[model samples]
Target: MHRHRGVAALAAAVVLWASFALTIRGIGASGLTPVDAAFLRFVTPVLLLAPWLPRALRAVRRERPGVVVALCLAGLPHFLLSALGGRLTTAALVGLLLPGSVPLFVAVILAVTRGERVRGRRLIALTAIVLGIAATAVLTTAGATTTGIGVLLAAGFVWAVYTIGLGRTRLDLISVVLVICTPAALVAAVLEVTGALPVNLTSAPVSHLALFVVLQGVGTGIFSTLSYGYAVRRLGSGIPAVIGAISPVLTTVLAVPLFGEPITAGVLVALALVVGGVITYNVKPRDRAGSALAGPPPAAGHRPHVRGLQPHLTTGVVEHPAAAGQLHLQ
Candidate 1:
């Protein structure tokens, strides 16, 4: 049941992302400033990743400057924008703008850059998904100002680019993460040294600070990524990527009980649009003969053909710190 396994992996990713919404909320409530909170998320992760730095060093050196720079943008800046934006707005907005809209961005990027054709059903699916995102924006709380939406959209753009950048880099997950984070950590270290970060960030409740470190560092940073990549391998990245559109719906529903938020008709409608759109996108078209995804398994010795399937970011789970291949997307 490879399909079932893929479903389970995507389900696990959804759960982790739902937790991520709450954790960003906790950071906002704490005494930590945006920069301070960004630093806090990276602190333990930097330390945890220190010993493995040497493994990534060579790749860091040899990789083209432009790719490394793009990775760096996707690394700390992406998190800083989203984490800070999460603080500035509702977690619902954070979930809605980032993960919810990424698939559309991926499709646009593939079409524009690779000359990949989007036709028939895919176009309709993309249209519904875009409408769904628009509906979420319409549900915006009075508290969700222009700035907050801008921040969330910024986060979404960077993450979409990050996913695109993945195809360009040859580095495995862990090494790329290391290369990405090392420069960012250095920048944060400079900020801390310059007294730009809060002087008493440690004074924020130790329990809460520890919560941020553990969840951001270990849970979201490591485990969720591994699971998402696993699903990509099992189902091919296309299915899981489309399935990930449901993350916003899942986060909003779970938040009703966890954060005491109320449900609304808009969210329900958005959920329906997204789910229907994703399912429609995956269906094989009947009118088109020799459809790309409709063929049987290839003969032995022939590499299987796929249309629009994303390359796996990493082969398998990281067995150790030295091998902790990149597990991103959260």
Candidate 2:
């Protein structure tokens, strides 16, 4: 039952994430700047989750300073980069590069920081993902588009660091969400009030404002993070990560009609490679003990043990610092 709930939550998160790409790409038509969109994104959750602020603050004091910094980097800064990149390029590319490149960046970070080895299929999958990203970059014609890709790649790297840091922290889902969103919302509010960033929330068309408030504020800001975190807690990181590979395809297909973005052959090839690589990378490998280690597949009602995580048998939820941190929607 818990696993089923996790799958449902993960599916919802994937759709929400695709809509995020669409909304960011459509910010221009809505008469909102990236800053305006980002403000809406950051502030809504902070307000709705206000009750958890004290807990989040307590967690921050206990967490490593670097982990807090990583969470902040993945907040407003990541959103701005993603928004700018979405504006400069197609929504298809925004979907493609942001999530597509994350695993590769995570792998590199792990290798450099921890000297982790990537052997077998995982190495091959990373290589395929890298080639796909390179192909997408090489096929771009416009300078602005190229720059957008670079920015999105940088955003992916920042998010990867956040993913690692999340795994290291012991904060619960609500605390983690508050920790990331509160500071970003405060900073954005100050910027808007001080005339540093443009303010259009009051003057933009009601329809546009409503759309952003619902989609960016409620959907991406709150539900996406909460749902994804819950899904990770129930389902573990591997299944949800593999299932998330569908976002690029879903976003690209939706964009064709919504934004009239053309799907080129090159984009198709790149998407296939990236999606395929992500799936391959998440496949569980056989144990060294061969057939005995392989063992039988879990029964229909059996909950698989998530490697590296301690399960809370009473609650049936996996507790890990990284579970809630696996979110990559930004």
Candidate 3:
């Protein structure tokens, strides 16, 4: 049976992520520095989701030690790097560039390392993502912060590795997420406590921290942990990837209308291209026979994987081989 629940979860992820852009705009309006903003974003999610620690730790104890370690290694760094990158770059640029980079990185790494052949539809989807992002970039100006863009790009690469790494592991849904998030939260909180943060939340910027709480605690800490796996179980791996293209478009559109940030021609182009790419990629060839009638793609049935470090940021369903306890490729 098609799982509508996964689709709903994916949709929620898209909305929450897009709202992330607006949240940045809100912080900007509040006159906080990007570092403080980024710190809060990361820290809040950890705090809000801290309640899950007991269960998460129990799951960790139940799972293989190596698998838990792998999850922490793969997922934690991505979030750490991405949060740092966001401090350097504009949220719109991050939105547009990050997600667009994942499939490309995944395909190349897979082909080279695992000997997995990249196929037609995935290739086309990749092409569409690039072209759409290019069009968006051309239409809008990200203010000549090429260095910032580079940082975000590196962050994206870290996330791409995380996504691929998820495929290699055999951990269950709760175990996998906890393994990733617990360490990430600890790391980020440590940084905050140690004064690595750019803006001092102790001063005038206290109000902005509340926004951070909302963004991380509700938007990421809670939702992302479950969304990817749910989508995978309900919809399928490929479908969520395609549907995720909606994130950049939705975020950019909402930024201006709701947050009063000016919308640009580039944003519009990006929106169109992303939608087009997603549609093109999701559609199957008529020549192929299938068991069920195609409607809007069903939800995937896997738990969410963190996307904090990628070019765009993310979550996805993953299924690991039963005995491998290692990363699996889709």
lDDT value for model 2: 0.69
Report the Cα lDDT for candidate 1: 0.58
Best-performing candidate as measured by lDDT: 2
Each model's C-alpha lDDT?
0.58, 0.69, 0.52
What does candidate 3's lDDT look like per residue over 1-330, in tens digits?
347676787677667666554454455456555545545554554465467767767656665564455456434454444445555555565566655565566677778977888578757866876786567446545554555556556655655666655554445454454566556556655655776755555674655667666655456544654564466456644555456666776666666666554566666675566556655554444545552223333333333332211112442112111000111243
Question: Going through the candidates in order, what is the number of backbone clashes in each?
Answer: 3, 1, 37
Best by TM-score: 2
- TM-score versus the correct structure, for each prediction: 0.77, 0.85, 0.72
| Model 2 ranges off by over 4 Å | 1-4, 232-237, 286-330
Which 10 consecutive positions of candidate 3 have the poorest summed lDDT?
A: 317-326
- Give the root-mean-square deviation of each candidate in angstroms: 6.3, 6.1, 6.3
**Which candidate, 1 or 2, has the higher TM-score?**
2
For residues 24-125, what per-residue lDDT tens digits would candidate 1 score against the true structure? 655667776655655665565567778777878976777777766756665567767777777776656565655545556667767797777777876887
Ranking by TM-score: 2, 1, 3
lDDT of 2 by residue, 1-330 (tens): 987897898787778777777887898788887777778877887899898888778867987898778767667877788778888899888787777777788788888988887888878988888998888889989999999999878877777767666556666656766777788788888877786877676678888878887877787776766565566667755566566678788889999999999999889988988878877876556567553212332222212122322111000011111111122221
